[model samples]
Target: MNQPLLEMQDVKISFTTSTGVVEAVRGVDLSIYPGQSVAIVGESGSGKSTTAMAILGLLPGTGRVTGGRILFEGQDITHFNDKQFEALRGNKIGLVPQDPMSNLNPVWRIGTQIDESLRANHVVKGSEHHHRVVELLEEAGLPDAERRAKQYPHEFSGGMRQRALIAMGLAARPKLLIADEPTSALDVTVQKTILDHLDTLTAELGNAVLFITHDLGLAAERAEHLIVMHRGRIVESGPSREVLRDPQHPYTRRLVTAAPSLASSRIRAAREAGLESAELVAATADGEKPQETVISVKNLCKEFDIRGQRGEKKVLKAVDDVSFDLHRGTTLALVGESGSGKSTVANMVLNLLEPTSGTIAYEGQDTSNLSRKQLFDLRRKMQVVFQNPYGSLDPMYSIFKCIEEPLALHRVGSRKEREQRVAELLDMVSMPRSAMRRYPNELSGGQRQRIAIARALALKPDVLVLDEAVSALDVLVQNQIIQLLAQLQRDLELSYLFITHDLAVVRQTADDIVVMKKGQVVEQGTSDEVFENPQQDYTKNLINSVPGLHIEIGTGENLGLAE
Candidate 1:
């Protein structure tokens, strides 16, 4: 109705490669009204970010806008040169990049980075610049803004660093803000706060927001309008609520059904439709007694003594008297925000870190009391899958070697047997045998994670400590991995201690859930009980913090079985 703030008509972007030119965005049409919030949602390589980059004239490498126009305030700037673009960037259109770690300069203090943006845009100067930096940090919700401004990016936590980035992005009070996966790495609660702050700030400043993300739930919940992209083309576009409530495109439907937040209802539908396999259903049949405990953690306490400003020792209770049980062939998820001791508990269970107090029992045997040889042997029964697949895997090693290394170290099988096992492991993870020779850098994020999973399974471990294993993956890839883990649990009768900040994912994969905060267990219950009726205020807040939690989709009885 009103004049659009930013508009893209038939925007085409391409990049020159060794082979030829590859089209990244194909005639995508999108618009964001003044002070409006719009989201572009898609999986990886779907051109969501590419379209955003085109608007900012910041496409990397050999990328160039080959056709169409990007109109800002009724002017077509498609052919704008770097000098012209510089005049608009930061002052007119600000960008909050996806990865804060890579986006922020490591050598600079948080205040210095924000000040540079302010100075570059000529927004403030000298004493006023220093004051502006603190104001920006405070606006971004950073605590003790003045003190925090002196700290480097490394000194801040993941959420804090993201807040610093947000402060920098909004430092100039641009007319439009393009936040690319701004909260992907943050916990759900922290994500909610950051997004809420961004929305409030943008609305107050009359700034339009073009939010690019792979999270369908987040997009649906946060944006007024939604554009679903697939293979460089728009498959669906409309009000976010309308598109999500009744998706017309097959791809959109897949995303909705695959989303872990919505998957719990889908599971109910699958059961009612008898679409799930009989074995899989029977493995988790109701009325059956709970399985025996595989790993039991009791009174787990981890404390770190650090020197304070006055050089006095201060005790930080990373994990305080936390307790939980992982049942045989069941998943137990530890849900909490960053610094909430979820990972600390996981590391303790894996024996990667020793607890200051408490006991970790494996099949009734105290892990701390085990002899060196016994502990070494115990590693064969318990394994871990870390958060970052790329970081977990060695770039120098082939996929086959990565998987085979574990078996070789444990002396589990002969040379030929290990080779055969490697192939089988890859197949189990739905990877082809041909991928064996490829290095980590050659694979996609999902493929690399599968390789990591294969490596974890190589030892034939009965238990797995999956610490945010699928947190970094796209929704589709995350769904696939969740399904794979479900199947593996059924087939191998494996128990899992899943540690993550994603409650949406936990609802889908975890049978039992543990809610932790400040190194303490706030609540614990079955997934159904916890999700449907949370007992603790903290748990309620966590569930409420999940984006799209308010959208009530029809059940199997109403919408029929999901395909």
Candidate 2:
């Protein structure tokens, strides 16, 4: 075999804080050969990202490699200064970070950012930078590259922005391309497109890829080798399929069991089996949804008037004649890519935004012209939990205060009763009561999400608008939250209008799915029906985008034990 493009041997990383020295990565060893694809999979704080940062010399805040060596082309570059690392960064080692909006310059045009990368790395002469930028964007699967190149970051959709980042990363055709959770925020179809294009580019350029993600299924699909990191140490490393199919470590097994792509069908099957055994069932014998409709929508339309720079008028149909019924004690997931009007639909349903032409009926009551008091009453029955756990919670307030505030606002009960209700809510979400005094900053991402759920449930709402609630979590944490939601739904008989781009998660949780594209419903059906046989090309693309389902890891084998 040829010499490894990048190598890490007994690498140790640490950070200095006011409290003490904290070891982030310890005694890690790995190698990335030329054109070889590899991934490090782990939950938050598992140090998978830290390893990538070390290799790229982009570690933040008092972090340093305390031991071992990192070799690039058989030369030790572990202790290279910023100037030395800078030369290698966009030239020999490219990076595609997790978030595009943050990585991109909001002030500059998309083409400008790409041009800067080209100029910095000397990929092309300055005179040829603009043409090269357009070529790169088009190569990254973005359409209408010439027009798209002139647009700013906010003007582009999430998928387009991601393509721009990929273009920037591969602009120099680096020897090693590091993708840190690159498609975590994207929809399944767009994610698949991005990964496919990335694979092609890296393969064509003979560039090795180091993928960082919390999803084991994604790792298995995108890479040949899988490295599982937990608490700064590599617990398992092998062929991706072998590791997923026959996980030796407890953590690896947990990841496989929880990954949505691998376990979506299995989760549904298991949940249904449990329901069949139980005295109470959510569905009928024929697998039909409950006849009782909780929220009904008809001909919902939202239009935004866009005025051009010269004051020319254009109409943007955000939600075009969309209609769906949310049944009692069932989940109806609105699935689509960004700007598909799913979130806009959710907003109107929540009564936060009014539609230009539509009717929303809560329990057969039209909500269009509800009185102030009636709107307040409606809110008590319908609460929303947003996607960002970190941003949703109030850092200044304690967990108890955050949860109790909703109860206090609604005047649900007396002060003592509200306190008791908050306690029960915490217990329902499987959170320790000790967490009540802690602020959002002190808790992990999963814990914060649980708190957010608890807060939303404080009013004993009949419907929960979970807008990408668990999308930001790790697979294991996401599964835990999903299980919690299931238990809550069974106990409370709550109906959910779940909004997300994650079809795999929807496959397990949603009884019915409303697939949208360009502000229109592309397909609508039962989750099983939709997943088993997608009727539309867009729906099929979404299902195909989901990784690891094609890999045969059955319930009787690896996953039954996972459960």
Candidate 3:
């Protein structure tokens, strides 16, 4: 192998807080050869990003490189001044940040932003800059390059925005690209395109990529080398295939085993276990009935008022003649990318937003024309768990109070009863009793989400709507949440309206699946039928776009683990 394009030796980064020094990266070693992709895999707060920041000389105000040697092209750059580092940025090294919305200036046009990046890197201005920006967009595989250049970042979709970021990074033709979760928020289709483009461009340019993400499958697909980070330390490092095929570290093995596709098998096994358990009891004869429909939507239509430069028009058809049914005591997943009307359908079902047309029947009761009072009553029958854990819960309230609010509001129980119920709910959701006193900020994302689920269940609702519930969590945490949801459904006979962009999650939790595109249901069927023999071209494309789909052994077995 050729000499590495970049190397970090015995690197250490720490933040000085009032409590003490917080070491974010400790004794880390990494190298990226030209044209090779290296993935730094870890959960949030695992020091992955901190290490990347140190490499880019973009660490937070409080963070300092306490000890390290950062070498680029065999040259030591530990003490490079701002001007020197600035010269390297975009020209020598480019960064694709985790949050595209946060990284791209909201006010700037996409083309202008790319132009500015090029200018900063001394890539020429005026016509030359414009031409380079267009070329970069083309290279990034963004369609309608000319029109997209004039559009603001807000106008672009999540995937398009991410592509624009990649275009910006490629504008100066940098030697190295540091991408932090580049495809994290994108749908499988867009993710595949972006990653494929990255792979192609990197190969053509002989440029190296320092990719960072928690998705082990993605790492396996796009990277050649792998580094596993945990609590500010590099726990493992090796060739990507070798690392994934035989992960020496326990954390890596756990992540591999926790993947959604793998979890689907576990779900299947659990279902079989339940069937066996039912057979064991003489009175519980093999009389288990097939699940029935819980919520059914027919010809659902929802149009959004698009306040555009032209004028206010109902041009955005958020949900267009969508039809689906949620089975009793089973999950019916609505899968799509952002703005595909999955969330809009969920909102309409919850009565948070009114649909322009169509009928929503809850256990055969038409819900389209429900009055405010009727809607309030309907709320008791159906509960919602939102995507963001922090945004869903009231930070001011304790965990116990948060969970109890729904029961108290519905007048289900007295204060004393509510408190006892909340404790029971927490226990049911696998939360610690001690957590009742903690605020939302005190809990982990997974823990906070468990509380949200408990609150959702407080009404004893027959149906639950979970919108991107586990998409925000890391693999292991997501697996746990998925398993918990399945177990809860079995125990309480709860039905789920699971809306997600994650195909893996859909496969795990959804018995039936609905694929939506441009506000319409393009396909609908059982998970097995859809996954095994997708009829619609869109559905087939979605299945094909799933990263590492061909590699079914999972990170655990691939990484070399034996249960």
Candidate 4:
């Protein structure tokens, strides 16, 4: 491979804990050649992001490189000091962190951060720096880069901020680009767009990329090579197409099988095999069933006030007369584009925001006029996992404290009992008890999210509201979480109010589907019925817009579904 551009030889990372030393990444070896795009895939806590962080010299303060050699351009950069690493960082190896929401300085202008990232390693101050910043932004495919350069990170949308992060990463034309779950939070269209840009950039720059993600589909689509991590070691590594088509390792095969698209296919195949029909008939035999109605809404309305340029006010119906029912032990997915009131309905259900009009009932109880105490108790029965895990968690608290807070607030158990419960909850979420002491910054995006889910399940809530819980996760971790949710729902008979824009997730996770448009339910049915025979124009449009819809596994080329 012409002396790989970057190499990690027998890399090992550990963190000192009260109990003992915890090994995160163990005896792992990987390499990246010029113009090559390699993906690192694993479940949460598998050290995928840890490996990427090590590459960028951005590992947490508590972590130590127990043993390894990080060779960048054939030079062992493992022992590089802060000053040396800082110099090499942007100029040689740029990083696009997973969560741009917090990685970006909310107070600083986007242009300023991009310039700062570039100037950190190489000085180019004043107007020259500004020009270069704008140029980099343009190269990253951001529209009106010149004007956007003056705006703060908050002024930009999630996708725009992610593009800005990429622009910053490319500011120095680094030899290698490391993107950790770069498109994890984006919708399918935006995710495809981002990957397309990355592909274009790699081809144009001839720079190697270390793309860290869990989505096997995305990794297969974007990367030339794939590396699968399990626990702390590499289980599989090979050409993306080969590995994806015929994964050798059990872990890799499990990941591929767990992917939402692949899972959906399995579901379809099982239905064709009459498995679903038999299961549905058996489930139907459970008499009366209260129709399994977990959540019922009628004429739900939400409005937002937007001000005019002249300070005049305008009340807009963000969600208008939205209505749907969530059945017991099944996922009811709400799908729509950005600003489609999917989240608005979720917020209303959680009682985080008051609705403008209409009714929301849980288990035949009207929640519209509940008192503060009643609402608080209702919240205990229904918990939420937000879209951004980092934002949802308290930065100052450890994972243990974060999970414990909910239990304590609900007065579910005593101090010692709560501690034990917290441990069990962590274990239930497939996280180690040792994660308790680590802060949010100490964990990866997927780890933090698992903790968030654990916290939500602390009180054994009957209903769980997952608002893009798996959206920010890599494909592998996303699969694990999806499986976990399915298992948990089956075991506990828990109802999931899954709010998402991803049609793929809807297809896999949802039993019933609710298609929302302008805050109204345009179409509703079983997932199979909705996707296979979408009745409404809006629902059909959403299904048509799904990316990678026509990707062929055996053909090795575009399946040619649509552009």
TM-score of the candidate numbered 4? 0.77
- Candidate 1: stretches off by over 4 Å: 264-289, 554-563
238-331 in candidate 2: lDDT tens per residue? 9997887778887887788788787764544555566342211223222445769999999999999999757999899999999999999889
Question: Is candidate 1 or 3 superior in lDDT?
Answer: 1
Q: Give residue 526's lDDT in candidate 4 (0 to 100).
A: 78
Checking candidate 3 for backbone clashes, the offending pairs are 244-558, 244-559, 245-558, 245-559, 245-560, 246-559, 246-560, 247-559
Instruction: Return whichever of 2 and 4 wins on TM-score.
Output: 2
RMSD values for the candidates in order, in angstroms, are 2.6, 2.9, 4.2, 6.1
* Per-model TM-score on C-alpha atoms: 0.95, 0.94, 0.90, 0.77
Worst 10 residues of 1 by lDDT: 277-286
- Per-residue lDDT, model 1, residue 29, is 89
User: Clashes per prediction?
Assistant: 0, 0, 8, 4
Top TM-score model: 1
lDDT of 1 at 395: 92
In model 2, the Cα lDDT at residue 7 comes to 94
Per-residue CA lDDT of candidate 1, range 127-216, in tens? 799999999999999989999999998888988999998998898999999999999999999899999998897778888999999888
Local distance difference test values of all predictions, in order: 0.87, 0.88, 0.83, 0.81
